[model samples]
Target chain A: MYSVEELVWNDSFINWVRYNKNSDFWESLRASDPAVEENIRKAALIVKAAAATPEIPVEESEAAEVWNRIRRDTAEPETGNRKWHWAVASVAAAFLVFLGIYNYGKTDTRVSYENLISEVASSDYKEIRNDGPDPVSVSLPDRSSVVLYQGSKIGYSLSGYNREKREVYFSGEGFFEVSKNPQKPFFVYSNELITKVLGTSFTIKAPENSEKIEVIVKSGKVEVITRKDPRKKKVLESKELEEGNYLVENQKIDLERATMKLSPIVKRELTELNHAVQQMKFDFDEEPVTRIIADLELAYNVRISYDKVKWQGTKLTAHLSDEPLYDKIEMICKAIEAEYEVRPDKIVIK
Target chain B: MTRLWRSFIAGDEDAFSEIYEAFFKILYRYGYHFAADHSLVKDAIQELFTDLWRLRSNLSDTTSVKFYLFRSLRRRLHTLAGGEDVYQALPLSENDLRGLQTDSREQYLIDKETEEIHLKQLGEGINKLTTRQREALRLKYYEGFTLSEAASIMNMNEQSVRNLIQRAIISLRSLLS
Candidate 1:
């Protein structure tokens, strides 16, 4: 006959009692001997009693607050090299002047494009100036691509790029095709406007001399928030061009530089804005369904959820272009004899 | 879990956050069981993570992330407590004993009243064990650590850990009978 301690210390017995694993083996052992069955029952009791420890609750905010402290403690110092320190100081001075012009509405100061370029000209920043007559294509550290129009410039911090966030300061017209990384959001700062995206293609026109800025959404979603003081890093007001809205695609948002007012202007005949859309290729030849869904997810900045194992080895062969995003999804689902549901935050395909 | 650790060592911030999220609560419970100090446990856990990130480059890959974290947290709490006597056995709190009686398997084995009486006796019996015995029982039964892993965590040999758990169960069984 087995003893209680022997049964309690057995790994397979503990697994059976605690996790219901390998019940058949334990059952056969129990039926073989009556004393062993009694020992098994007692051992199971001991395991369950010992495993029933009290739990301590942790708040969600507590985790976030601790992470914030860790992030702050581990952040690199802003001033390191002495030579670059002087350059950063000059850029800070010029930035202060630009902020002064913005806050005071000093048209007499007349901040020129040259002043804007100098303001962002820190040694830590990777500045791209398109001096050629044609638009120059530039690649970001995260593999996102930007088409900088002639006589315009864009700059981003070299240290924090693609690490903490993908941020860039722009004073130009540019078409952006941002790679999808939901963890590190992409932000574009032009004058008072801050455009945030996860992944999408769009166009922004914010010239240093113009009193108005325009943001056109060719694909995906974009959030535009105003910042009164860039030093404070506080958002004043926000607007989002969400997907599924009537004005989602080829929609234009005009921001008055003087008042910082945002108004949406719907114009269906903005045929020139369709260049990026036409450039996207949606032809698939026996591509895996997961890959197709992933591509669509990146292009639209939307989350698509489906049973990966259930759809494993499922392939599609279709040309899904020219139609809207929903229609394209419907066509694929119909071809596969599946159904889809659009949730507020994600799309579910079954 | 090993994949998460590899990515974390490779400086993936998302993977680091995932590791923290996965292990924070259990680590908190383990530390609190010994010290019973809320802020002290919190500080120990925070320091554990901070040190892990700073020393990640020196860390080798490990398949048992839980064992590594638990051992590190225990060592950290030991230093923070300033003495080894902080591990003295304390009686299970009233709520903890109540938790024992509510175990579904115990209910399946016996009636509610008998279960309560037996669990009370078991709780008292468990409290009577040495601190090392109690730690061994917890690591082996509750945390599901294997004998060698528990031995390493407690700085004991495997045979001694097994003997500790054996004596603990024998004493508790006598109390129940």
Candidate 2:
């Protein structure tokens, strides 16, 4: 049997050979080797058998018609449980058809809302309930993510998706991994407070009275502004919070200079920096040998062989890539009052 | 929809509806593949399309409707499949699901052979690769995207994409030969 390599490498020639059993590409070669041509023809037979199975059809009408029926029944304004299945089916049909065609030409670019809107539509907003004690997750249309906390109700508008903004209404707590969109700012409405972000990973807390609305920045910076604040009707008291920062109400603002008073936004940049340092084996400006040895061992999976008397009190300072461990080890050895040699997988200090 | 795409971008409802009708199936099918649930899939596809329609004015600048549909399908599928934690859904045992003989290796072979005979062999050679390989090919070929684009979507390094494409073409050439 021909290998995957042979078949894939000359796929065009093979295909050409398969379709035109006696094409020139093969003619020149086949004249010298009839067996290879025969093999190529036989491969074509196998390929034909596969294609005969049926190409997944791209239908515009069935999906469209399903949605049409859904729109018709749903528009009646008196839909019951009976209509729900059919409505859901129509939406499913539209979804499947759209998927088959869309994946047919897998795109590399992120799909824009405008482009997404043009491709398809369905009318079904079925609730997904997870009874597990753990958090239940629900993904939105724009590729952002939502982890619904226990006992929460969030609804989406599929049919009326092509609006000015992409909004999801949530009645409880949820963490969001929002897909980035410079134009369409994602809004999560909870407890009379609407949190808007471009693209970020954050947990939204909308507890009761002392239940403050908190936006914890996980990765990207989020501009959490009051969507409906009486104080700034046009634009709420907005603050740009970075990673490891908290934006909340009633928090005291640091009055900087007369022109710039820090808002209620507070960032614990130091905390994050400290945590990052904890992961480091050695981050030292003073005695560097111990730290260097610890980091080098972790990097190269090797043990150090050095005299405690010679290297005990030695220290050095350097930034390691944590990659290409040997290079770092060499740099460290040169910096110190010692030298080193690589023995198989292990490094020995001399 | 009664109006054309241009009209929809102009904020015409009729044109928006027409665009919706034309592309609804593509979105729904892709969603079903990803979500594997009828109701969840439907709601996602519908919501995405409706959202798109509402923002039809922005559609004026886009070139291909298909690219938009696929991209949306991927996003929605990621949502249904567990968002950031997509690997949560493990591949079902053959007995658990349809038990159809859809083994990756077998599919790879048949798919490659079929492409060799029917589709452009060079293209098929590129197509009949691992899902990752095929995607890398599509980004490089069909969309003319930079290696960076392929890497971002595949969530791999740009250097990795370059290496993958290079290897894919080598394999393709050998198959053709």
Candidate 3:
């Protein structure tokens, strides 16, 4: 008969206790050695108890928050020295030039906006056409909102909108407020330029007849890359774009159709024409806490719950434009001497 | 999981997120065990994933993603904790004992009144173990990793890990009696 410690240390016994595996073998052993049955039971209990060690619970919101930080950190272009891949790429490019076979591998994979739309026309893509005189709002399946300008159109696969990735094809001008989802990147394919973001508000102007497609970043980081180049087609290249081609808050990138070149412009003055999402003022001067909370809820598309009666007369005065949504909440909570808990679906202020 | 890792290495954003979702909690729990600091553990995990993403091209496929992440997070937490000895024995807090009791009661589906006293004693006995002993038991029995896998994670020989666990169980039995 095996000792309790021997049974406890056995891998098969542990597996059986934890997952109910190898039951036949365990049952035969128990039947053959009835004297070891008690030892077996005790060992199983020990394994179960050991596995039941209390774990630090990680809330869904907490995981998402950390993920957002990771996404943001990784999305930023690696500062200083070119990454190894770029070094290899440059060396290979130079070698190709030396071999005089560069032009032989140059294949033009560019497609027009009309062709792109027609290709998706047969699919079950939900197409939103703004025939109205003014810009109309379009809400996507992933809670991302798009303000489609007159004579503009946006289409996305209804089935795959938020499942794998949030992808949308657009023509003409539109202001996009994409919801934060680091796992599923938000992709806006407009003309020759594709603007990718984890979660950010931006404006894409890609008129069907315009020579230049523009991406204006109102807030958060935005990556604009040429849609035609297969080498740079992978969304992972957002890291590479951070080095040279990515757009940050208040910056803009204009993609020339003729040359397929990206020119990033640092716009100091964000006019009303380009900065659509930034119109919502985050700077508050003695604003009622209720109003400020409502604005935050509207801006971030998150619900903030608290005792209305307790905070009826609370007011906030702070410049929150430069801070992230969570930081802004933290600052507000600090001013009010309150603690905020991030739940799965909502933020609770106590 | 291997498919997801391969896709992540191939620059698939969705796969990267999938891997993160799959491993975040377990990594968090393991990191917490190493160091109780909430933000510190969170930062270690965050940096671990960030580095993984940054060096994804250099990473090879692993059959056991959990073991790989656990090793990475352990190394990271060790460094972030300023090279403090993670094997050093730590006094179990009252909260930990209470948490153990509740967890065991819920997991075993046993008669609560009858098992409470015994489970409490078991928890105390388990808690009295050295951090190394607890970690070895945790990796072997709780996580269900193979002996060699646990030894590798603990940076010790398999026989040494086996001895540590045997000693831990003997001590627990003595304490229980």
lDDT by residue (B7-37, candidate 3, tens digit) is 7888765567778878888888777877777
Candidate 1, residue A277: how far the Cα is off, in Å: 20
Candidate-wise lDDT, in order: 0.67, 0.45, 0.67
Across residues A1-350, which tens digit of lDDT does each residue of candidate 1 receive?
56887788788888887777898998788779877867776776677666656556676666655655565455445344322211211100000001111233545424444454454447777889876544555667776766666666888878867876688888767667676677777778777666777766565665566676666655456666555434224321222234443224555566666666666655323343422222445677999987777666544445576666678799999785434456567888998899999653346788
The per-candidate count of clashes, in order, stands at 0, 51, 0
Model 3 bad stretches (over 4 Å): A31-33, A76-350, B87-115, B175-177
> What's candidate 2's DockQ score?
0.04
DockQ of 3: 0.19
Candidate 2 lDDT, A99-193, residue by residue in tens: 00112232232222223223333344434443433454455666565555555545556764325455665544455556556466656554334
Ranking by lDDT: 3, 1, 2
Residue lDDT tens for model 3, A1-350: 57887888787887777777897998678767656765775665566556655646788777887886787678755354422212211100000000011122222544556666665645777888977554555667766667667677899876767777778888866767666677888777776677777776665666665665666665577776787656555663333335555666555656666667767566624342432223565677898898788766654445577656588897879876534456667889999999998655357788
1 against 2, candidate with superior lDDT: 1
Name the top TM-score candidate.
1
Positional deviation of B160 in candidate 3, in angstroms?
A: 2.1
lDDT of 1 at A255: 62
